[model samples]
Target: MAQAKKQSSIKVKVQKFGTALSGMIMPNIGAIIAWGLTAAFFMYPHGWFPNKEINNLVNPMLRFLLPLLIGYTGGKMVDDDRGAVAGAIGTLGVIVGTDQPMFLGAMIMGPLSAWLLKKLDQVFQDKIKSGFEMIYNNFSLGILGMIMAIFAYFIIGPVMEVGSQWASAGVNAIIRVHLLPLANIIIEPAKVLFLNNAIGNGILVPLGIQQAAQVGKSVLFLMESNPGPGLGILLAFTLFGKGKSKSSAPGAAIIEFFGGVHEIYFPYVLMKPSLILAAIGGGVTGTFLFTTLGGGLKAAASPGSILAILLVSAKDAYFGNIVGVLGAAVVSFIIAAIILKHDKSTGEDLDAKQKEMQAMKAESKGQAMPEAEDAHESVKSYENVKKVIFACDAGMGSSAMGASLLRDKFKKAGIDVSVTNTAVRNLKDEDGLLVVTQEELADRSLQKTPHAMHVAVGNFLSSPKYDTIVASFKALTQVEDKPKQEKPVKKVGSIDGIDFSKVKEVNFIRHDQHLGTATMATSLFSDAMKKAGKTTPVKAVRINELTDDPSHLVIVTPAANKNLAVRYSDIQTLVVKNLLQDKKLNEAVEKLN
Candidate 1:
């Protein structure tokens, strides 16, 4: 047990580090895609239609714009807007002396520079005079940015270039040994463990960008982003798995293959850990085919969707890329099928496994398992929520898809709230914000935005949590839009006929079918009475349990009141339209002794 905990701790540390690395690159994927399209369609000789004017964007974007944006974002992740400027300033230092894109350097300098500035401010900020604050802030940032830039230009740039070369050399060595495909042994498992962003955006993308700069295309972009293996696993579940896992696989497959939300299929693998072997087999097969057929992509596919893969595919490598995805799918499906066929378990309880997976995921992110018991405990938090954000490890993939779905739901329901998607690291703590994230990422989301209400979903595509959010907001809009009356009408004679001074105990009679409602109504009314400073006791009991006494006040429906009148003549009763919400019942609680 101790060893297991130690290993889990190490995994969490690695995941956190990876998440930080990916947080820098993932937000700038759009810029990366723009550079890729320019390179693929307009670069001289290699591009489909070379244009010197359009191609001008290719090199500058790769070297200056991309790295600086990454650095700025990385710094923002560490220390907000001030850090972002500092990070960008420091990143320019590395770009000055190198022909290669300094992604690694940007990653290091952006956060480091911002963090340094933040620390410095912590010491001097309180000591600054009130009137000179603006001048101090400006000059401090300027001086620090300048120093960091010079340091990066001289020290970090050349160092990162050598490090980048060594990394490239190591990958080339693996290719020479014909063991490049074996990388799946690590990539496949890392992905299921929710470290996909770290492995893909953080590591593979930078390498792919460097390789593409040299040769116009790189298979490294496809290594971790490939959707084939996950697709295969879903297809196998659709055919051979049992219970909910089997039924949910078809939709999950669509999301994985076409929609590019690979996270939708992770629960299936978690439900059956043995399926990871299939993922490995499929990944190895795909990489081998990609390598053998000279398949390469011009840029990383953010979601790893088949469409995105084809869109960014090198002009000449279409067939190779298609074959690689298909081959991997076929190989993965076969292995998964064999494993499912040989299973001896009665029926896999996917719901339990899913919850277990969520628990494990929460544990890894350094939080206790989330409880549904409190899902509605803080309904008031949703009242002023002006917007909703769907967050995931990488904001571009699963969260984007989930956000789109929720946005549509909100539109149809006439909910005017804004809906958006972003990486969890980018979530901010502010008023009027509601965050929805995958259960695995809930802890991180909470940490980033403790002021915001959070909802964790097991499946992004079709979690009931989305409907709950829609319903809650829909009710809020109705309440807000409702016009008020000039004068409030008080319930007078409805409860005036009852002699509430004689009542010492209030009872809600429970029936076989209505026991739950009766219990809930009694509890609510009890709280309302106490809040009004009444000392009356309240209880829910069976019809036969009521005593024949005026001291017991029975709140019942019209039908139940008739039965109560037949049962006992001395019992006092008030017929209410609703067991819990009737205005008459609320007024009576105020008069209770």
Candidate 2:
């Protein structure tokens, strides 16, 4: 059910291009690693069986299998099944023409071939007749695949070979001279900007695994995986930061250092963009030390976790790796602290912005609900209410905290209700349950659990609405809505101290309010009464339209605008609280003839 995430940022095309590159490589990394391991164990100069038979498997794997896999992955990204087929076919030409393995060539042509076919389909797709659709699909792909294969062999394969060799030479020269520190210029900024996941997991890890297999270790493993930069930044905040950041920095540091959740520190750096210098300084310092000491690991330390790194350490370089990490952290922390002190950004603004972000983040998952009122109200009884639940996307973080806060509030109020948190997807319709979520998600939550009373808040952490809800719970015990007999009671059907019956028309009045809760509630209640065989017209009118007419039953919506209602209360009147609840609505309607 996971759709491709929409990317709208124009700063770089990385979300599309970088993500596609990562997607193509990640799925086949296991196979690539398997080939590398096979070569190391059975076909290398140090292999037990260094014979021609072992060498035979190696060449075919490098030339045919690897390139085809890359091509298939690349093509699939562009145009699914047909793209994969075309990519594989085009890559075969590269495999045939080149004595050397066409790694780079396969990557380029795979997605390129897929993209080319996708364009062809876009052009011919509308023209193809319904009955001949299958034939068109098959023949078009076949012809295009043949064309790309021929083109790859004659044109692209040779040119890519030279380019790959040149890139390789440049990289080797940089590594040899220990100018690898220069890489931090790009790496540090990318990591801070959240592009590190693609750079590390997609590109570096697979290549690192290949290198590690042949030489028993690879410095490439440490390039993007070093956690020192983020760790240093978080540590700096923990020691010398200001405002909400100072309070939050310790928790962020613990998670980043021990849990390897580097994203915890991203917001802190983003608060002050100049802090990127701290990251780069740390990255360069760590990488330089790692390169100088020839520090590496036997495998990719995924998560860039220090514990994962230590567990996969290459022999004779463990101490050097540890020393490099420490050096990076200390240097980054010092620079970050200086930058933080010099920057004059206000803490209150950051705190407010952070809260806004949290609210906005939850809001993005849903849309505003229709304000149109429902004619048939199905209000769930709170008489036997046993539990309340807070529901959200993941259920573990914000929802859980909201549930806990509500639970604490209930305890203080002496309410014997059980409160819990759950994922929205896990909700089941049940009686005596209350479902609370952000207002934006309220509609979805109601759809999932219509039997439960749905409550919504603009924010979960702190809101005044919870207090109003608790007061409502107290009133639940005192009020009992039932069909009335002949005898009339004083102040009956009172909502915020206004009641009405035995009037010619229930005139709904709003001064300047547009189509909202007032308009909706009036339309629905009026329609319902008309359906129930009541002859009295339910009229909508403006405040200025009303006269000193005692025949009219005037009611106001949001009923909090009591000042407006007081202006015309001489006649029968009802001030509807926030909404038209079924119980209160029934009492007022049933009281009529």
Candidate 3:
């Protein structure tokens, strides 16, 4: 029983670690897409290309807001304000690290930094419990956070600047020298596969905006200049679509091509991943066709659909645009039909299986209808009578910020409300809770409070969306409660080798000592330790290097040093237990009282 329990606990821990790591990685997906779009649009300006205006508009927004959003989401997941702050700071590092725009680097860096910080917190949490709290509660987290910001600005910024210039020059040289034709060939498929995003924002928008200045001429010009991938997809549908699918193809094509909604054809291609290859082939052919025909537009393409290109292209290029669109369509149709014809049986099977799964899900949902209703009713009633608690993964950063924002909105509207930030699992029935979180976290809290109304506020805390919801709450209620007590400060423990008599705070440094990142860890740990508030400065030594002094506390990885400090009876028993787990750090500090 004991072994099974231990395994179960470890499994949960591992799963939590994985989730946190994934959370750090996934939110940047949108930002990366945005960056790709911005980059392509800046470099290309034909109806099929991007332009300078797009770069200017998109760059600043993506650079600042993308990381902010990622950091906000990441922090909400952990429910740590400090971690969220760290994520934002780290994203800045990545922006500085990459050759692409700041947004792209941040998309990569935000999560990396969040994960690094989380790991660091996990390792040295026990060692610097009081210091972490002190820094966080006293705004030292902000100061340290700025240090990371400066590091990115000075160090990572210069490196990326030099690297990106070199890379761009190299790519330009290769395209010009060895791969001119190949570049055109690559452009279409790349546009379809990778450059589609660029085409939409980079090529389409600037052109559209420019055209907006002379609406009729711009719209007409665009129509003939750059019929993009949508035209190809439409052609594919017209040629290869069968039965009811054929009837739907025209609408999908129209929407994707002219309506400038490229997403219209995603479902069709998804139904057949092989269609992607055909699409890519068609895209390559179409790109070459357009380039050869001298089809060009003045601005960026919005959706890179046939209609959008025609609307934004110059009048002189209209005939060329039409030819390019038709050529792409013909090529795509032939390719799709040939490939799809060979896989009819697979398509049918996929359709049948999809239907079966849908039916099964419906049946299961029907069976559980009553339970779901009961849960909903229970939560609604609880919210009406109990204190409303707001939660995220981390209790501090985004959640606290969100909670404060909501509280003010509620107050302004004269709604009686008590809002506090807390970890999702800490929510109780007495504390009627509404979890405002990124869509990804809805499941985590919803499972425990099945009836709770989960507002899928994707990074709502940062945007005005949070305020909007609070206003709604205010409209519904008129009662208000007095402010809650401030969270109490946690006291530091007296370890033998560590001198707390002169030290008022502790600093934790985290690194994978077993791996080669040890030196980096040492530096970070030493710097953090040095920043601890003390009447007298103290030197830090590694856990393995520590002598067996009764006054010294050894800091090491949790896996290897679990038993080391656990044996000390005089070391505050409560603090030791709190530091044993990473998630419990704040609670552990609270326990010190």
Candidate 4:
């Protein structure tokens, strides 16, 4: 029975792995469509819209909007509002930091951010209680969301950018300064173990491109036809794989090599870390073979899969490709077999460590303790403690931003409150602590504290929604304040002579890659508007100076389309869209429109 249970567990794990892998690939379906469309227009200039104009519009839209949409949707599916907000913020971070277009950044960062946020939320969710909800629901949650966004922007974004650049540079330097054989020997190992595709393409190909072009060959042709790390993995499996896993190894290698899904081998490698060296050895061998055989590819072969290589390789390099693939496979198999002979079980230790960590977390959060203790504590000091503390991954960026925003809102409403930012782990004893985070981070220790409240802020801090939160807190606290009447706004005219009554309002989606606050707002507004049967164009605009002109409107026309330029002057009202500032003008425009 125990043996059967273990097999069942392994089967379940495999099933989950397959499902996740499939899901990850599904997004690429849309990505391929976008890539194909863009490639067609770039390659065939006379096919559709004017090449230059189409290029300009399509690039920005794909880079920014498409990724944002996909990420937001994915996040929503994962963790609802909070995940959606995090996805949007992560997409913005990628856009601001990378020189690459938004589409690629979004593709990578959106899911990554969502995953991080979800994980963080799970780690901190249980420590909050209902009494503290007054504060948790008010400002603490938003503050936490902001902190997470900032962490992603400053830490993750820059590291990825620098890493890509450095890897590319290092690869090129090796190939240029050393002999082709020596260079391959070094690069192959790095690619196999570290899975550094950026280094391979960014550095290796540029050198190969220049070398091939100089020698009267197409740069693209050389890159496309080249066999890469995939071949190395295959070689290792062919020689080393034996017994029950032998057949699985060759099949897995072929899938990884040809399908360009490098992750397929991760389980195998994880099961035996010594395979790292073996894979590296194979990689170096393959690289040497590739250079010697004059193997090259025209385009990048992501996943280094055999199929991707074949698709991108030059027509005449078929023999060179086969030789390189076989060479890498043989070398890797020998290395892996030698390494695996000395390998031991590492999963048992890892499982033990995971359990230990969970226990520690439970203790720290007070979940393992009794409920009566918490009830007794809450009753002891129910009236005197009036403060709420907000904790996040980092106290600097989002926490600070959120705290400041909430502070202003609370002050404006004449609600007296105190708030501070602290790392989640640093949170200590407080009278009425409200722990605001994703559901994942709620701790039982937080609940046992008697006055603690856990409110999940999903992600992304909206000032308007937070204002309502402050209002709720004020009501709960019985703070006395007179309500102010809504101010009347001057009516603005529209150019189309369409009934002003039909137009609801004009709003701007301001974003600068640091925080996608604008995109989140726009998405919310659009969703709300669509529900109400409203339609409006969301235009992109550049804001040069904050104080340039409150009344000045700048109209941007498509390139070489002077005929459309005069249309702006003919309109009575201008709805400007700047993805930077959150202001009353947006509301006014929305209302007027």
C-alpha local distance difference test of each model: 0.82, 0.66, 0.46, 0.46
Cα error, residue 448 of model 4, in Å, equals 24
Q: Which window of ten consecutive residues has the lowest lDDT sum in model 2?
A: 370-379
For model 1, the run of ten residues with the poorest summed lDDT: 369-378
Per-candidate total of colliding backbone pairs? 0, 0, 40, 65
TM-score of each: 0.73, 0.54, 0.40, 0.34
Q: How high a TM-score does candidate 1 get? A: 0.73
Candidate 3 Cα outliers beyond 4 Å, as residue runs: 1-84, 90-100, 120-140, 177-240, 258-277, 289-327, 337-350, 353-593
Question: Cα miss at 85, model 3 (Å)?
Answer: 3.6
Candidate 2 lDDT tens digits, 137-223: 678999999999999998898887677567556666888998988888898888655556567656666456545544656777777
lDDT of 4 by residue, 1-593 (tens): 45643653453344333323223323343453344345334423432333765556544554565556655655654555566677677767765666643333444555666676767655643343313323332344355446645765677667766765664466555555534444444444433332233334334443333333223222222232234444454445456554434445576556556655453454355445567665666566665666666665533445456776665454455566667767776776677766655545432332233234335444544454222223234433222335545554323333454566667777888867676665443454544455443222234225333345444332213223354456456555554437879875543332343344543333332223412443444455555556656565332222311122223332221221132232222222433343333353345344543
| Cα-based lDDT at residue 43, candidate 1 | 96
RMSD, every candidate, angstroms: 17.4, 18.1, 16.2, 21.6
State which candidate has the highest TM-score: 1
Write the candidate numbers in order of decreasing lDDT.
1, 2, 3, 4
